[model samples]
Each structure stands twice: as C-alpha cells, then as structure tokens.
Target: MRNWTISGTLTVEPAEQRTDLLAEPVAKALAALESPDAGVVEIDPELADTGAFCEAYSSPMSASANCVVVAGKRAGEVRYAAALVLATTRADVNGVIKRRLDVRKASFAPMDEAVELTGMAYGGITPVGLPADWPILIDKAVADSPELVIGSGIRGGKLLVTGELLASLPGAEVIEDLAKPVA
Candidate 1:
C-alpha cells in the first residue's frame, strides 16, 4: 500500500489518496515547488527503530517535523484538528488549541482511531490528506524552521520542505503555543 503512494511524480490526483481526516498536503506541495523530490524517503535502519516520532533521535531543532491530530468537542460539535509541532515538546492543546477553536475540551485523537480514520499508518499521518473541514494548527516553531520533514501522506516516507511553505497550505492555520516547556 505504501508503494502506491511512493511514485516519482503524479500527473493527476488519485482518489485512493484522499481521506476524511486530512487534505492531500503533499500534492499541493508538489504543485507549489514543481519538484517531485520535495518529498523523499529516508529509510535508514536507525530510523526504523525510533517509532513514529523523531524527537528522540536528536534535539527538537534537529528532529524531523511532526503534526498532531486532535479530536475535540467544539461549540457542541465534535470536530477534528491537526496541529503541526516539533516533537521536542508536546502540543499545548488545552491552552493553544482549545482557545483557538473556541472549544472546551481538545485532546489528542486516540491512536487506534487516528490511524484508522486518517487513512494513514500510526506514525505517518501528515497534514496532507486531511479533511477540508478540519482545522490545521501550525506551531510558531514549525513555521520558524528553515525546512521541515513532514509526513508525505504516507508512512514509509516524508516531505522535506520550508516551514513557510507548510504554513501556506490552503487550510492551515498558524498559531502560537505549539508546545509546553520541558519540565
């Protein structure tokens, strides 16, 4: 399944790539840069053992980019949002996310359900392929980075791009409080 999305370049959007959880961020990215290598694979054996996150592999400043998918209750409506943050710190959902969406309770989407609904593997859900209705939050830190290695709409690879470009994704909403300080 991963191989299906691992194409060199695409001439048209594939239906199987779309999902209710997120938009096809990578496709927009491809159109943005006009370069296919914008998203590439890093299949080093060391990374294979690091689980879904990359913070443990290096400092937050050096880690690959990450985004958090949140399922919450907003305005009496059950909604979903994705927050892009560096793995060094956790997404400040209660303080950052809750306040932005005017929601009372915002929590990380359950792992089992996140993978199932997002249509991506546990560690591979990217901002792309997310539903249009869902709000995507970008941490200031992510926007500050020179480039980010975010998920490439798949589990086996990631897209390395400028933080500013990521912020420009059609439905992305940039916000502060992407994380909490290390205690």
Candidate 2:
C-alpha cells in the first residue's frame, strides 16, 4: 500500500500505485473510502461504450459520467487543467477551459502529452493522481448521479464513488455549465 496523506495540505496519495482495477485493488479502496456506497461494476476495455458507461456514461450505470482533463503549455509555461464533462456531451474547451487556464488560446493536450505528464493512462486519468496545481472543471450533471466511476490510476479499472465523494477528492472542484451535450 502506498497511501499517503499530506498532514497540512489535505491531500491523499494511494498506498500502492496499481495500473488498473482488479478485485483486490477495488476491494481495498472500497474498504478504505469514508463512505462505501457505490457497488462494483466490471467494464471491458476494448469497447468505448463500456468504458463510457462505467467511467463516463450515467444512464446504464447509476453513477457514471465523462471526464476530460487537459494539460498543455502556453507562452513557454506549463499548465494542467481538467473537465469532468458528462459522457452525453463533449467539453466546451474553447468556452470554459480557455478562460479557466487564463489564455487566449487553449486546446486539449495531445493524448501522448497528457499521458507523459500526468503519469496516468489515457482512460484511467482521474483527479486522484493529478498534480496539485492542475485546475478541474466538473460538470453539473454529476450532481444528478448517486455515484460516479472515475479513473483509478489505471485504464482497466475504475473507482466507484458518490458524486460528493468524488468532489471530496484532492484537487477536485465543481464547475457549473462547464459543457453541453454533443450533437
């Protein structure tokens, strides 16, 4: 276990760094959560819908929604930003993120760029392991779900938690009108 808590910073690092969710990792985290409410659900990696359902979609699963975190550099300075967009819609990157990052121009960091800097799998990118300075953009839709499955530091696994719980994670912030459903 590689769990760590910042005594003054109010942050927590996992005890062990697992690539994805297995029964063991899930079970351990479930037991560790302050509130153990959401149930475990298995998802297939090959199917985008499955990942979306378990990780981003909210209909099939009671607690699920989309998440997109953008990282990039502007004017020779590095920045990390994220959006917990509902799977139903795509992020309004130009609308919300540009202002949030305080730049006239902004875009989703390349997949390779995000993976390299965040040190988390593309699909597995969660707010948990994110850098302290990163800014998060959470969708209002998440409030509707009882719980939501976000990344678990690994693409193959998910962390099932309540919306409130997810909000409670370190470096997480709730944003209203962050995006609109994709047409």
Candidate whose TM-score is highest: 1
- Residue-level lDDT tens digits of model 2 in 127-170: 55565677767776775555455655455555555566556655
Per residue, candidate 1 scores C-alpha lDDT tens digits across 109-142 of 9998787777666666777656667787888888
**Candidate number achieving the greatest lDDT relative to the actual structure:** 1
Q: Ten residues in a row with the worst lDDT in model 2?
A: 1-10
Q: How many backbone clashes does candidate 2 have?
A: 12
Report the lDDT of model 1 for residue 14: 28
Residue 34, model 1: Cα distance from true site in angstroms: 6.3
- Candidate 1 segments whose C-alpha is farther than 4 A from its true place: 1-37, 44-63
Q: Write down the RMSD of candidate 1 (Cα, Å).
A: 7.4
Instruction: Give the whole-model CA lDDT for all candidates, comma-separated.
Output: 0.61, 0.57
Q: What are the runs in model 2 whose C-alpha is more than 4 Å off? A: 1-42, 48-63
